[model samples]
Target: MPTPAATTTDLTGRLAVVTGAANGIGRASAIHLARNGADVVLIDIHESGLAETAEEIGRLRRAAHPMRVDCTDNAQIVDAFQRIEREIKSVDILLNNVGQSARERASEFWCSEPETWDFILKLNLYTAMTCSRQVVPGMRERRSGKIISIASEAAYMGSQGVADYAAAKAGIIGLTRALARELAPFHVNVNAVCPGPIRTAAADRLPIWEQYLKETPMGFAGEPQDVANVVVFFASDQSRYITGQSLIVNGGRWWS
Candidate 1:
């Protein structure tokens, strides 16, 4: 039988791939993993942010490869994974982090447009589907891998204006749970982290900050690290027995 996976949190000698890693939770997660001794691959569409993240990874003395790709583009997704297999060699962990909600104030669902719906579905939903597909082969071959995705509380709470965003993120949760059941026999764990009101520049521009604040019992917005910490646990063997589960990192905001 294959040896048991490491239950400790140390990621030395492991390789991790994080999507949407230009800033916020993505950036924090990449650095945190690197600090714990994992070589990281950062993927995002923002060239400047990717460069900055790469430079910081360099300072940490861990290998960081930045790949720029429009998350919605299937061809670019394939190319990114091919480069990862060629350059990074293997993917011990995959963090599906590319996502966004439309920047607008509260409005009725009727105001949602098809263009917006399509954009939200592609970024928040399809990106994870494609990226996860890319890594499953290698993981299945080795009979081990960790897949951690960044979902959101809006998925469960049902944010009114960003209905598309909520639906897409909810789809991620469904994907994680379903994939976990299939991948479990291969020793690959799949789980998701649902963050609430993370205080990032993007969050600042959110139209419903007050709504989030009122929902959060902690009386403050969560930071990127708050979400990243749970991600690290899920990515490591520390969460070996946990699968098909979604953890809400909202500091007691939403229980579901």
Candidate 2:
């Protein structure tokens, strides 16, 4: 049997791969992971943002490898992971964080185009599956790993004008539970973090930003770091016994 994770939160010597690490929660989570002593591999399509994130991690004295890959493309994802395995090391933690609501094209579901739904589903759901596929083999072989995907409260609350986004994120929760069950025997943990009303660059651009704040029970929007803290918990030994669970980080918005 594989050895268990240590009882503390220290991530020393562990290698973590975080997608969408260019900014927002992805960037925050990567930084937090590094602060906890884990070397991180940052993946994103934005080169400038990746560089900035890497620089910050460098200041923390933790190894950070930034890879600019369009995660929506399966070929690119496969190629990138191949490079990761060859150049870096096997990933001990995989953060499937690349997703978008495609707010630019937001419309009522009846008015939504198939093209928009396609983009939303691919970016929000398929990317997680593809990225997880890359690391699952190695993790299963090693009999230990952590896979965390960033889902959204919209999945449960059923927000308007984002049906596609909600469906995609809901798919993430479903994927987490199924994969967790499948990998549990190998000591791998699969989980989802669902954030609500976090004040991200993307969220700030939403037309309903003011409405979201009003609806939030906390009476204020959350920061990316708020969600990042929960992510760090799942990434550390603190969550070793937790799997197939979706932990909501929204402040009193919805209860599970």
Candidate 3:
């Protein structure tokens, strides 16, 4: 088998923008890109974690710019992207990784509250839209770009409590498909990755995550790198012909 480095060219001059990159799969993906020679721009709401992530990437001798911005805010997203373009030059890759989940509870379309419903949509779906819209214009101008959104397995399998989050993620899947079709003419590939049972700090807070792992086909919880590796594939030339698809890194949890 070819070494991972041999599978992708040196991304030395390429600029990559990764949102929610302060920790978890986002952090791993940003680091992986840097290891392979891509200059990375890390954006997250968590300023301290962003700083730590940037420092680690710097240790790899790769250029890393860490910024704090609310991805759900349109003006903030616009300003951040423009600043990155001006300072880092251009963005060749965009990873929309910002996501949040609320405590799951019994609910149906009939009993859902408006506040929870809008919060889920605004945080998950609108955030991705704001970031994608900012980076895509320049990508279209260059006639080349790669965009990846991190989704979740619940969107497909239907989690019991997080109805709002699942609906938002399902919307992300649709958005990925639509954007891929629209941007195909510009040579931009857009896709989403659905990760299940990855052991992150946040995962520790949820009791259901362990139950999900107990039922996984692989019989083990995943590490951040497992998901990061797939994201790297979608962002690289190896996946040039792939678009509008959702690659599940759930270790056979859902089989689809």
Candidate 4:
């Protein structure tokens, strides 16, 4: 009988594409993926930050392709993925990490403006859908891939003032389940990582930062790497049997 292969988190030779790879969880996850042996494609609107992340990954002796893509614009996303296909050939893992809460415009549901809601939904939900479409066909044909999205704890445990953000994230969880089932037979695993208040530049700018710290049962917010750790797990073969699930990394904020 042949010896069984050891279960490990070795992503060597895989190519991972991470949206919003300019900073926070995206940057952390991208770097972590590279550390584990995967070459990464960094996609973000922030050119300088993408360069910085690419530099860090290059130091790991892995290839890093940085692309400046305004995710909210479907045209840009289509163009970017076209370039990805032409230049990189294939994508083994995809991290849909681009999201925003529009905290500065947070308000009562009744007071929220249509434009604000549109912006929030476009940035958070639509971008994920668009990006997934770009890679799903190839993944299905190849019969192996991983799709991980960065959702939020707000999706499950509702929050005041950010209803649009919460709704968008909930949509992500819904998408994950449906896509997971559809792609399961093809060996594609789809999952979402719902992070609570992680210590990111965006989180620090939110007005409810203090409130988030107080609510977390762990007594403090988590770091970006905390979520990145989970991202790496889902991206690897170690999570081969897990799909259509939302893993929360919010320091016990919600027990789902």
- Decoy 2 TM-score against native: 0.97
Report the C-alpha lDDT of model 1 over 184-214, residue by residue, as the tens digit. Answer: 9999999999988899999998777877888
Q: What order do you get sorting by lDDT, best first? A: 4, 2, 1, 3
What are the lDDT figures for the candidates, one per model? 0.89, 0.93, 0.87, 0.94
Model 1 global lDDT (CA atoms, 0 to 1) = 0.89
Candidate 2 lDDT, tens digit per residue, 192-254? 999999999999999988988887887888999998888889998899889999988787886
User: Pairs clashing in candidate 4?
Assistant: none
* Model 2 CA deviation exceeding 4 Å by range: 1-6
Which residue pairs clash in candidate 1? none
Candidate 3 stretches greater than 4 Å from native: 1-9, 104-112
Please give, for residues 1-256, the per-residue lDDT of candidate 4 as tens digits.
Answer: 3554767889999999999999999999999999999999999999999999999999999999999888989999999888988988688999999999977889989989999999999999999999999999999999999999999999989888899999999999999999999999999999999999899988899987998888888898899999999999999989988999999898888632
lDDT of 3 by residue, 75-157 (tens): 88889988987877888998989887865533665788888888778878998988898888988999999999999998999
When summed lDDT is taken over every stretch of 10 residues in candidate 2, the lowest stretch is 247-256
All candidates: TM-score? 0.95, 0.97, 0.92, 0.97
Give candidate 3's total backbone clashes.
2
lDDT of 1 at 17: 94
Against the true structure, candidate 3 reaches a TM-score of 0.92
